[model samples]
Target: MTMDRKGLSPDQLKEMYRQLLYPRLIEEKMLILLRQGKISKWFSGIGQEAIAVGATLALDPDEWIMPLHRNLGVFTARNMPLSRLFMQWQGMQEGYSMGRERSFHFGSPEHHICGMISHLGPQLAVADGAALAYRLNETSRVVLAFSGEGGTSEGDFHEALNVAAVWDLPVIFLVENNGYALSTPVQEQFRCISIADKARGYGMEGITIDGNDLLTVYDTIKGVRDYCIRNQKPYLVECTTFRMRGHEEASGTKYVPDALFDLWAQKDPIAQYEQQLLKEQLLTEDEIASIRQTLKQQIEAELEAADSGSTLIIDTAAELDAVYAAPAITALPTVTDEMPATEKRFVEAIRDGLYQSLERDAQLVIMGQDIAEYGGAFKVTEGLVAVFGKERIRNTPICESAILGAALGLNLEGKKAIVEMQFADFVSVGFNQIVNNLAKIHYRWGQAANVVIRMPTGAGVGAGPFHSQSNEAWFVHTPGLKVVYPSTAVDAKGLLMAAIEDPNPVLFFEHKALYRSISEPVPDEPYVVEIGKARRVQEGTDIAIITYGMGVVWAEDYAAAHPEISVELLDLRSLQPLDHAAIRASVKRTGKVLVLHEDTLTGGIGAEIAAWISEHCFSMLDAPVLRCASLDTPIPFNTELEKNFLAKQRLEQSVEELLGY
Candidate 1:
């Protein structure tokens, strides 16, 4: 068939042809390399090459681009060397090179390519977060996020789209509709006719483009990009494309009908564009032939360069250094020597801790919803933005997953990230990131995910189920995560400081009611309370009460009021590495025990304590270990119901019964 090129410049046509030719050649070579044991398995965007080249050509290199598996066009356009890309596919240590590799999902920031993730859809929020940071930082840069049509099925996609649209973030959502997701086709995935149409629900402009037409794709992307740059508005572009190859190397196309293949063959973007180049006289047959030869030679050269190179050798020491680059605790300021003996309130201690930590570590960053200028939902971060500047104290777009994901990436890059959830109840939004990614990094890859997550938790605020929750049990049960619940301002400051300096991921639970109502002798100076160390708040020989966070205060008060009942109160600071030593000592001494917390009695930390005691100290106990905690019902909005929901005071009454044992 004679290819026709019409209404296009020679240079433009040449660029488009070159884009298609080189990437396809490279992809094929990489696959061959896989067979020859030269490279690892790779996902190719062969049939959808036109859109990849077209869409990326219109983006700003300085602006961020979060690439997925099908974005070979993006990396190539951004100037990622062909040999290096091949090396990475081969799993070479040099192949893992990126100046900002950890931050951008393994993409080189210098190349303006953010990292690609295998986790389907969450990268959309991460791109938006980078855009959010840019907006806050007053940079003119935008973010272009790419994903497949199937990823739209994830809640992260909609959450990201809605957040970006409502906030008018400078982001472009590019959805490459490549026919099928492994085996599931778009027909079976959603009822929506086009992915772009979903953007309208978010009150954003949506466009459906012919992904094959190079000029058409370019013009469409360019227009939306300009719109975003000028108005800071976000847009969604649905690039209708097809995957000519099977899902992966092992998959076959036996399920696809010949008729569908025939129809798509006629509309092959590369062929159509080649036809246009010839038809428009943009290039003679000889010129097109010559260009093709040159591209083929270039691809051959890259393949040779990669093949001649030795197998990727990883440096164990360098990898260890990369994984263990967290700052030492000695680098942080400690307040043990300067702490005043006077009493202080819980909120004051938190404020002091934040200020001191920020002063000590300039790399420390705190971001959350309403944190900038608004202080915090509970005013814990009050005056922080004014002291630390907006760059350090950032305000996010209400995407909890995005907030946590960005924090994970930042922490990976050796930046200390501290994020707060308005209420612990809403933490469920980003629970997947915490449990799956945060908790797994240290154990899975030996990478320290140094992140401090603060949440105002527990009931009694009358905020109801949606607002009031003590869900530390959820993460405490999760391994590789440290949970800290402090009742006193002194403990809050000390534990929070320790969490910031520690190498592991720490979850700090700050009770909202205690923020103002509770007070203790907290030093104005900095101090770090050791993790996994329990403090004896009150001395008693009759029975030991083990609790944490706000529950510790109630346990102390209950012990103090009951003179007839000599209660030993132990505050277990860290949940993961529970203070078994203190628990054993108290149980063995008193010969009785009581476990307490603000969370529900069922499956709470108290349950674990009871189990542990039964396992180790069952023979030494004078009576069965009892539990004092909230009821199983959700916190109610009514004050009376909320008060009645707690088991602390009721447990105080129950202590009398336990003493009888």
Candidate 2:
């Protein structure tokens, strides 16, 4: 009997059939465990087993695979132990940290398989980036990013595909069209007839194959994988499959009609493969029974072995590394700034600093939306694309999440990524990736995310509330992130270099109001401004004027006016490990202090700075650390109201009050 129609050899058909059956049984057992409340949660790729198994079979074992939540079958096919899989569902740290085998958590890092990420479609960018890494490193390994059709609607999906296409990355984007995304059907989610068709728009090949057909799955993936490896290009493979079971064990098939279930169940990959194997004379009824019994016993024994052991504890050593890993310390060459007498726009200084850094570090990669060719929205990257070339200064899709997510991934891979959020207001869309993932990765897993996120914050331009507003305080509150708001051209250049060199994640908040509005003598040299350090821009003996970002400029101007009152002006370049020493020293000398920032008064960095001053210098203070911030109201669209609502005069008044004390 064959593998095609009863004309295939026994081993040829049965081996592939067996791979599908193993994961199916394992998935069923896991679902039962989940239903019995023995496991936390389980996302089963039950009916869509063939593609998972086939894709793994088609690829080289050493190549990379980033499984989504439902790609347990893919993991198993790629050599993850079934017992480890069960334990992961049970939330056992041991489940994630066992053996020479690539546990789910580590995802065979040595084998080139990265760990799974929970966010939908975000993994695609990482996968593409990984492929880029392979290309850069001159490795033959390809990366496969698995996602659902529902993920197609996500901005990240388009971003990842476009990046992969533009770079001609050796990555395979596998869309497991499981008919529905959670509860939303494919039709309602996207306008595209087929998820694969989205590939054509990105200048890539898109292939649709019967997911349940193991041969078709194997053949298509093999062809695509080979094509990607050779041409170093990406392709979208849409494997059409039905989820005979619901999304998860808790979600019953009631939402799915019994008739549809019965219809897909007939074409069930496991059962159909069994029939194929039987027809090929690969397995007699007795042999099939024995194989089932043997496989079940083996899995049960493995589970029993796993169950007998203590639950895997979180890797405390790994956690320690995550929480307190020493930051990469780059020694800076001493540049005795003789106060170079020259003037330059704030943006020009930023450009100069970036150019110097690019000339300095080959590891630094600048990326953002329309950064290349477009020279960025403000022309900050005007000639960077040409100088650094597309490989380094690349453009991303309109996806804010992907831009940040890809940056984070590259940082994890030890690349310094400078990600620009075109406007500060748009940073909110990618806030989760920044605050939750980027900020917490090192804290969560002792990993250093050497990435600098540049947000053009602050209002002045008529870009309205969306494009304006200060968000430094939001990031300041998030631990594990260093926030910087450089107000001067020289400071901008120095601080930006420092942020890029710092080991921790830095949010470099460039006020759009100051990006070009301000100018100073920026030295034509690479420099480093230390993080968590504040600059004493001016000296005073009576009052301490503290501010950050755009507010720093205002505070300096206010201090210049209040020459009668000795006002020590401090520009807090770093926001996280704030220049507490500078604040305390100034406050102690002045006896009175005022904190100012562009964000709202309620929870701005000013509040934290005030608290810190009160804690450290309260006994030495003549009065409280007064604060002046924008009123708790939306930044009005009216240009007049916008200026009036957050006037520098208000800051000057606050400083005057502190002086009165």
Best candidate per TM-score, number?
2
lDDT of each: 0.77, 0.77
Give Cα distance to truth, residue 209, candidate 2, Å: 1.6
Model 2 lDDT on a 0 to 1 scale:
0.77
lDDT (Cα, tens digit) per residue for candidate 2, span 1-661: 5556333355756777777788878877777776687766666788898988889888898777877767767777776776666665555655553421222434545444566545666667777766776776678868888889888888778878887887788989898997888878887888877887788899999988899988888888888888998999999999999987778767766666677787888888888777766776667889888878888887898898779767455566765455434756677643347745468899998998888888888878888888999999988989998888988898876777767777766654457789888887888888777776677655544456788888888886766777888877788777778888887888788888888887788899888878767786767767777767788888878877788777877877766766677778888887877877888888888888878777888988788888887887779988977888887777878988888768464876776676676
lDDT of 1 by residue, 568-624 (tens): 888887787699998999898798888888888899988999999999999989899
What is the Å distance of residue 461 in model 1 from its true position? 4.8
